[model samples]
Target chain A: MIAAVLLSLWIGSSTSSIAELRHALFSPDERVSDIAIREIRWPRTVTALAAGAALGMAGTLIQGHTRNPIAEPGLLGINQGAALAIVSVAVFSGPLQPWPQALLALGGALAASLIVFGIGRVDGRGASPITLVLVGAAVTALCAGVVSAIVLLSEAALETLRFWQVGSVVQGYDSFLALWPLLLAGTGLAMANARGLNALTLGEDSARALGITAPRARGIGLAAIVMLSGLAVTLAGPIAFLGLLVPHVARRIFGADYRWVIPGSAVCGALLLVVADVLGRMLARPGELPVGVVVAMLGAPFFIYVARRRKPVTV
Target chain B: MSARRTAPTALLLFLATLAVLCLHLSIGGTPIPLPDVVGSLLGISPDPRTELAIMEFRLPRSLAALCAGVGFGVAGALTQTVARNPLASPDILGVTNGAALGAVALLALTSQVQGLPMFLHAYGLPIAATLGGLLVSALVFSLVWHSSLESNRLVLVGLGMSGLCAALTSWMLTLGDVYNAQQALTWMAGTVNGVSWADLAIAPLVIAIGVALAAALRNQREVLALDSDTSRALGMDLGRDRIIMLGLATALAVAATVIAGPLAFVALASGHASRLIARSTVPPVAHSALVGAIFVLLADLAAARLFSVVLPAGVATAVIGAPYLIYLVIRQTRVRSA
Candidate 1:
């Protein structure tokens, strides 16, 4: 699915104008279609794919670890944390320098996850699914408040960060090139834990009986969550609904197997985002809607249907 | 159950609310002493500046907060009781987001309608929002009707509906011109800022109607909270009562959302707080009202006075209330584990 999306994006970029496309491919003219493709479309596609996959993996890990069908990076406040951090950086500092924002976002996401995890875990026991969700909601609300405070304080900052906060992909493409290593590391970690995650799903006691250390499994799961969600937020400004939507679609198509579900989610997420981005670009004609808005438009109703249909999975 | 025993708690809560209201009136960038604030309220000295600050600015805002908070608290209580889910609230029932979306849509569609009397415009938004909320509730209730309104499922459905409403709102904003988008965004954040006398007037009537209805069904709600089977066994019309309660709750939620964006966590936190304070199986609605009023009044005051940056009261409540919610969740988990 991801490959198809990439191919389509390439075709879409190339098909805008044959002469411009030829110039972009072979010409020294920086203003031609070739530069647009290589600099803009290519980087945008890569960022979307990386971010979507990371979000997908993160959502899957959250749902699996918590055993909550509704769990997602957004639900757990990771995205809000990242967004808040970015907003702070923009407000206090100036125009967004990419690497710093990414690092700050990563730290913020980790901090939020840890805080939520701590709140969810009471009396030194594993957290309940509902408890985790509610705690996440609370934390997210607080983070949103902080974001609002910052926005209200600085009109310039609000103007600069508002578009990004709303989940646009039009920001510095050059910055994304620097994030490849982080994305690779996170993706690798997530993939490596697929087997452990599979075992961990068979109830903690059963997993322990089968020689899987439940604590170790949970630790690894947390690491995967932090890495994937952090990286995803770094790449795209907290695009919600996709993380929740993609994994469910993957589970339905590929069954409950983690190996399939995880990779399937990544593929579906990438495809969904690319399509959403493309649709966003096309729908508005001259003025483009953000990919995040497009994804929400697509995902919300589907999310509602799935949520209503599924029985609650108690952790 | 002794009225005499309960009197102190009620009195304490009322006094606390009044104190917060007084503090709200007194504190701001231009601080007024409590005595002068009191004088202005009593109409003794009749200071025009104080009157403008109190009646024009603080009064409307405080009233907005009171109305919104009460509406949310009662709505939250009703929702939790009807759904039999501690997590269930107006936001979980999609009422808040539905109202927000409807309001946003109206704002987006109507360009020249901004300067009109706020009451007229406000009425449109809440009505549209309530309709949207009702549509979602009806849909979810029907969907889950086959297998009972499972607490978790109801919440999940509500969350999904919220997301959907939010998406539609975002889409509308994106389609809108810059000014419309700005207005829509401000409305979405659940701010009590810029509320006027007109806004205040609408809320009291809507909230009063909702409160009257909720009060009438309070006994039925309490009975229903004892479990549907028990209520049914007692010859109560459980379904009819549930529908009425749900409608009343949704209406209150819509009215509150219209007055004060979504005001995150108030409905959830206030209802929970009231239940905890009352320590009752069924939520204490009157206590919830007091708590809600106090909570919002304090939140607004904090936003107006405490913060160097002028943050919205909604934002302040979330900052404070969310931590408490987290504590509640963790505490609940511990209890369940034990």
Candidate 2:
């Protein structure tokens, strides 16, 4: 992860040398290289790391609580929820001040996730993982419809959101720093839920027998996901597939224990984003591809692979 | 349930579709009065401008919707029957996304590959899009083919592939300049607004062929919903039938996506809508095609007239389709339990 941070700082549209990177690290504000590295790349790196960690944690919590193999923030309408809120705000108001945008995104994600869960819980039939995913797709389509309607309504708003709508972190550090408080609070809440998440994975009956309050724990876990996913979208743009695949990868490496899975997912998620952002910069050259786009490129294949596996997928 | 599958209901649906189509032509931002529209259609109008609007602009757009709707409807019905799942539509099964990806890839590639051959340039996108849809459908089927073909597995896998294909398309959109991006975005939104006769040239042909193929497979459609073992017992070549059905669906969906972007929910809802309208236990493929045409034509009209802004037909479809999907889950499950 540290190497990834350094690696990200090393590359950009404008090339910088290793010596310049070292100098920027210690001397602080000595040269143009120092400022570019410090002001531009360093903040992006931190934002990527923090946002990735949050998404990873969110995916872990949601998947564990739902006990659904395919339960993912993107697959479950959280991203679309955040996106709809952000788009609505941008369309209604002018350009958003970053702090308030993040808060609204968090709120939207929570609302969307709750609706998805509620729909899934509507009947005994809708509660399966298949229904959850199908409902998520339907909700996402609905949100996309609403979004395009709003986009048609306002050209000025599209101008403001066009690039951001693609999901890049090119806006440097102001929004990233603004997102710090929420990221910290969300992560703290997630780590606290690690033990409870493990209990819920044992099924509701066993979980209650083991003295765990399944509903309250699931609610808290969902709150963590909403906060983390919201902040990530606000910090980055709405990177899909990161939260979907990262936790599964984390579980593969760290086993089923939430104690390890939570932190493991966090590290892996951060690593994936930092690497993706750097790769996006390198792949497209001077015109950098957005990190969210890159994650989708990679994550989609992983999604198919997991779906094709022989192990019977449990809801 | 089978007794109600009569000719009158199907004829009613067909007549209603025509009425909707006629209404779609008459109404828009500037409401052309029904009398004038009828006059233009009958070639008795004195005003050339009214005739021009009816012939050049409105006629082509309406035809595009009608053709695309029929394509998606038949495709959706075929897919749903074969998969034995109401949700089995081109958009859900990754075929639509595959076509979208292929078209976008060509668009992106054309910009990248300067001085490309004129022949390739003219035909590349549609052909590529169709092939892409077929390839993805084949892949999804293969992935889902295990000890036994399962609807849930196919859907789940298709959903994954669809997401990936959509992502790839988005990445391609970002690679180009602003004009291309805007054009692609509009197309992606699934509108028939700017479709020229030239733009829609091959879609109708593909759709016609797809419809013919669907008609040929009508016999197999009933048996498709039966158990695989029972189908095999009935001397049905389950593998061959499934492939042919999948091919037909892919072709239909690809035809729709090529002309307009992947118009969401049309294929999924059309099959079920016809079932409800005709009150048939079996998925009414013939009615589904007509119902699909009606749905998209109405959606296009609603999208154009309902908002000050010209919304995509897809948005209006979702306004109806999303809730319908929710209702499907509840109603179907309730029926099963009862």
* Best candidate according to TM-score: 2
Error of 1 at A163 (Å): 6.6
lDDT of each: 0.75, 0.81
lDDT of 2 by residue, A171-284 (tens): 525677766777888888898888888777777788899888977887778778888888887777778889878888898899988889899999999999999999989887
Lowest lDDT block of 10, candidate 1 chain A:
A6-15
Measured by TM-score, how close is model 1 to the native structure? Answer: 0.89
**Compared with the true structure, what per-residue lDDT tens digits does model 2 show for residues B79-150?**
888888887788888898899888877777888878989977889988888878988988888887764255
* Off by more than 4 A, model 2: A163-172, A313-315, B1-4, B177-182, B332-338
Summarize candidate 1's per-residue lDDT along A1-315 as a digit string, tens digits.
645554534554234565665566566366755666766776677777878888888888888887877677877889788878778878767656677877888888999999888877775756666676677778887898888877877775686566555333446354467777876777777777777778888887888888888888788888888988888877777677788888888888998788888889888887887777777777765566667777777776776676666555432
TM-score of chain B of 1: 0.90
Q: Give the Å shift of residue A314 in candidate 1.
A: 11
iRMSD, all candidates: 2.5, 1.9
Assess each model's interface with DockQ, reporting 2 decimals per model.
0.62, 0.63
TM-score of chain A of each: 0.86, 0.93
Per-residue lDDT of candidate 1, residues B186-301 (tens digit):
55667777788976767678888887788677678788788777778999987788888888888888888878887777888888887777766766677777788888888887
